[model samples]
Target chain A: MGLLVVFGQIYDPAINAAALAFDRALRADLPDGVIETVPTFRSVLVRFDPLEISCPRLEGHLQELLARQDWLQAEPDDAAQHWVLPCVYGGARGPDLGKVADLMGRREDQVVAAHAAVELRVAMLGFSPGLAYLGQLPEAWNLARRSTLTPEVPAGSVLVAVRQTVLPATPIPTGWHAIGQTPFRAFVPAHRRPFLLAPGDRLRFEPVAEPCYAAFDQADFLRKSGG
Target chain B: MSGLEILSIAANATIQDAGRPGFLRYGLSAGGAVDPYALAEGQALLGNAPDDAALEFAGAGGRFLARSDVWLATSGAEMTLTVNGDARPWRQSFGLRAGDELRLGPPQTGVYAYLHVAGGFQTEQVLGSRSTHLRAGLGTVPRPGIVLPFRADLPHSQQPLKLPRPGSFSRRCFRVLPAPQADLFSAETRQRFLAQEFRIGQMRDRMGMRLEVEGSAAFQAETGLSIASDATNLGDVQITGDGTPVVLLVERGSAGGYPRLVTVISADLAALAQVPSGELIRFQEISRDDAVVELRKYRREINTLKDLVQPVFRDPHQISGLSGMNLIGGVIRGDEEDNHDDD
Candidate 1:
């Protein structure tokens, strides 16, 4: 059995840890019939079959298991995969890159350097198949989404909205500012595991010539953690 | 090989099954039938496997020809179904031989309808699902000149099964379960959400339905939050920046940056899907416990209907043809001379 009433609103840090702990606890402690658990940026949705266990019993079980430990103290997932996505920053490839630089009062190259400097973590995965929501941008990198949405941002485009970098798996109508382009597909039907980025994975962008876009599909994406 | 050769299909028509679940972790929404109840009903009537694929008619019906002997069950919003130019009753199963022509008219009361074959369509599976994820560019879209493959082992029920047809417009209010972000809106906006009647905007599809507050000021979030995109589910009622409410459906994205105010209860999703564009809708809030109980009841009812299968004794076309006559049987059969659709 798990949490009885299965309804709670939470706002807390260590979201990644909580997601990991939640997944572990549900898998390790709970009885069968837990159909699916969708871990989001803030909360985890536990879908269950009432025919197997009543809500009250499930809630009671969940509460007892959760009371044993604080989620924030749980170990974070260590299986983050790294990839070097070749990106062309601050040009037609990124119509919004200059805007982001101007907004931060930094030169275009500095913005690109700062973006490439950090290995961003995938805080969440959603919005589309294989789309990764990466975050923890430095304070100086804070930027808002465009007031008007760009009707279509091509697939593999790097977009910045608020403090997160979103890699859309498909062409999408977006409010986020497109700051770069990549040939490294996060999702491809041709692959066995179509989605590339899982929650908690990490990635860093590598600068490349914009003309490489013509042969971008031939480029290798998965790179070593360092260099 | 048993197959369906599409003669004409509405833009919205597509092949669908229960859909690919467990993929949301990879940022894929469960893209399946918009009106799942309809899908289930068709399956039940034919005693087909639970995961078999069916045709989802999202527009004014579609026309097709049977390439082999096939049995089909119709469910969802009420619509005119005809085989070989004869009117047929909906929510029932009938036999079709090779070369039989079938056509479905636009819905009379709701937006979408479903056609279930005796042996579910054998379309290639992507990630273990026959359902189409239109946004993800997955699965087969039904159109003219396309052939959908299926197995032909199951026998079509001789007696057509009839379940109670839902009244299209009677129920406009749906049950809601407020999500964590419900409190983010101003109290006034929250009240207006349950009290005001919203019209389904033209921009409606499997992904979601944009709702506009009818007549009065459109509901807009007075304040906004820099919320990170998070996992979303079917039935999540999301509020856009402009305050427009979009009700997420089966094809909803795996996650969304917009704040979700509430989610329509699972039991009400079928009703929500049938709600056509421009229709007025209201919401009634309920506790999660109550919602769960209701959902269980709904599932139980559908499962029970599986055993209620019986026969629609006399053939529909046996009558004068136009008289859709069945289930309480009285209307005169349609005149065969009405050749406009006969061709």
Candidate 2:
């Protein structure tokens, strides 16, 4: 563990922008001894080898980087891409779609429309390989994760909770509502580029019929979809 | 084809190396050997490369049959080694002829043991490494009857190397540095943590080891224990909501929300991994400067492992019924000696 440069207390676009900007700057001109820099929701975790630099020295270096610019107003990376993934909502594909609608006091179709309506930013990627935590869902859609775990959610699962949507690349247990399923895999180790999304990348889901989901070449989904 | 066929193996025994790093951004933890020191030791003994793959046996070893002539080395947790029903030195390298059965027993002192080949195991690499990441499904546990392939072309003219067993398993106290959320716990609670002696719990794996303390007065944080999800590093001591401390390891989740109180330094992680369950342990705080110095020393130690290795000269008098022994079939040829050190 090295040090954290906190940008804000809660999840905000500007705060995350600052964190991502700082992360980008750090990665661009990484200081000596720095092992890795992870950009989370509201902070950038700069893990460094203490053998190369002390914590105090690393902190001071980070402070110098922080003072170079007003990170709060930094623009998102220009290379950040916008993705639209085809998804199958409700029924067997989304076991918790009805549950989420019930909690939101809306019909299942309405819930689907509301969820697919807003584009979210990839605020963080963690917990499991290639699992992206997309953020800033409509305030009306803000919900809590389930009290009980859903034993296991498969890859491409669309999970929603606390104004964030999670897309897991592997089967994992979750507390969030699985409202949709996408064929697009965010993580493919065999691919030339394993990770499909990066921090600050924006994406929105496009509802497709279950049959249409099967038509999207599974093997070529990485190249075919996310257009 | 040179290969080691698995006759039988303990549960969770899998292939490992230095592990895959640089994937934390994609939520992948650097899953690798639990005791990297032992892996390096085996490599030194066998004259293998640093990233050579070896079988990491936890708690117990297993039975393997060589399909062809292959030089092998054993390291990590001390375990009884028997080649074709004859006992051999635990930390010595030896040759196994085709059909020779090499059996390893349960560890006598630590959790993980290693079996290395003269040439690294030629397993397929996933994401630039051959280390098994069970949780992430990168590799699978080797099962019985599976053949593990390796390169055995080079003739090892030098005598098999013999290295003394490391005393890391006996270490009880380890060095630690405060984690990012160390201040979340009150100073009094932190002091109590330093003063307390905990035992390794039965719940242990590549991911982490749980520490069990005496009595009901658990270490509590003055602030909220659950922080926003953030990247977790190796050796991080994460305190769960119920007040239990688990030392995250190589195969740990990339990110977690639990408050981390401290992190064991890299140099001491191998020793910490060797401490058996029920072993009592205490953590002492060390400054970043000191930890860095220790790491440099550790790197130097690993680099000079070849210096510690000595030739295991076979004694003619010690060989029982030398005339009746099938020396040519079992032993390596002496004339093939290539004096060049592979390291």
Candidate 3:
């Protein structure tokens, strides 16, 4: 029974760096029975077949790889890219918009301005397919998640909670406040890559008029290989 | 044309295979057979390729009409199977000619039963799998009246099937590795987590299974701080805000907000899938090295299953036409047939 766990400080920059570094390195040249590698904000979960590589041997190999390279100094992968996405921030699209503004003690329009002003980093994708966890919302938007969970929210809903924003890839329940809706679909099953956003991409929100945003048919993007 | 015409079905019955892996980056959990070993067992019985597609039915499968000569095998979940109104043995390959009828009753134990045809089922694949990932809206769930196509052109299987080693379908304990957030729980809560037996909640599905806490106070987190949502895979146990721990499965969302307390290792996940609601479950923390060793042992056992298979001399007692069936026929396939259990 060999199951190995490597833990890291969640939200620690260096640990996050290590997770991505190890994840990339592992996928590039993996041993037989290395089932999967999941990189989180602070941990790298390595699932391997023990019959193929003993736990101690697998651990040694991982340690050797980490010790061999300075992951912190590793060059940023050029594959990472940035994109501008459109969103509708109020009315039916954003039921919690006024509440978010009230929580921040700002006018409704001012809240959208502040939210749209910053570039959000995609930290990780999980909880559903293609759902990217974008983080470090300016302190003004750092409202805690609701204690009560909503039974379901539609896909492409932009949520803010715990100083982070998430665009759910699938319609799912959430405790986070939905402040907006976007036409940008992160997941397209028929696409070659399927997920529009990855763990390392950057994105910014551009507020659009309700009519235009409403007319932003999500199905239209399906015809063009999803961007 | 040879196919299986479903007479009835539960809502969740779907075509499944080895699941879609290496696609988590696309925001999908690897949607595959809930009990992959069952698929392997059926595949082994048919001598089909490892990744061949099969039918995964939940409780209450409907009657089916086998059109043309069809070789079929079943695994996972304990059920009462009847061919032409006579009791049929499970976990063995059996043949049915055109118009023969087979009925499967509700599972006696467990929740998923895999139906594998000789050459495997025919279904459109999504992302390299025919599995139904309901959350991601991926493949089809075969229901009543559906004519499920199989590879009738492929050669028929004459191989015997192995009896599942006792305890394969009804085990309750699983080995787990502590998650990164394991230390967040108080020592007392951690103790209770291991000591208390958790019952499976009725809110079970492919995404995850909720555990009934039964007054256990395993609800303590070191910090009020929540981790940034991270990547979650099958078998991760996340403690929800209501203090219930939901053990995620193959159709889980890519990530979530709750603190994950522990994760089940891969080797034990298949058995866990078959565990029906109300079944008590116990978890033990094992060393990483030990877990790996256990997985190796499990893999070894799976690989050697072929040796356990031997051709069965079966019985025949019925004749069925497209219009109707006759069950009282006294014609037995052969005197030397293994119909000793048929009575």
The TM-score values for the models, in the order shown, are: 0.85, 0.94, 0.85
Question: Which scores greater on TM-score, model 2 or model 3?
Answer: 2
**lDDT for each residue of candidate 3 in A115-196, tens digit (9 for 90 to 100):** 8988877767776777877865777777978889989988989899777888997897888889899987788788775777
Predicted candidate 1 versus true structure: per-residue lDDT over A162-210, tens digit per residue: 6678888888889998889888788877666677777666778998896
**Candidate 2: which stretches are off by over 4 Å?**
A53-57, A218-227, B156-158, B321-343
Best by DockQ: 2
Tell me the lDDT of model 3 at B98.
76
What ranges in model 3 sit over 4 Å off? A1-18, A25-33, A64-78, A210-227, B67-69, B155-165, B186-191, B213-216, B219-224, B260-262, B315-343
CA RMSD of each candidate after superposition: 6.0, 2.9, 4.7
lDDT of 1 by residue, B1-343 (tens): 6798999888888889999877877778778778777788888888887778998887587788999877788988888899989888888887676888998898887887888887789887888888888888888877788888877676532445666675534679999987657767788878878898888888988888898775676566555446655667678899887778898888888777677788888888778878888888889999877887888888887677687665555545555443432212321222323312322
Q: Chain B vs. true chain B: TM-score for each candidate?
A: 0.89, 0.93, 0.89
| Worst 10 contiguous positions by lDDT, candidate 3 chain A | A1-10
Per-candidate DockQ vs. reference: 0.45, 0.67, 0.49
Task: Please state the CAPRI-style docking class of candidate 3.
Answer: acceptable
lDDT of 2: 0.85
Error of 3 at A62 (Å): 3.4
- Candidate 3 chain B weakest ten by summed lDDT: B322-331
DockQ, candidate 3, comes to: 0.49
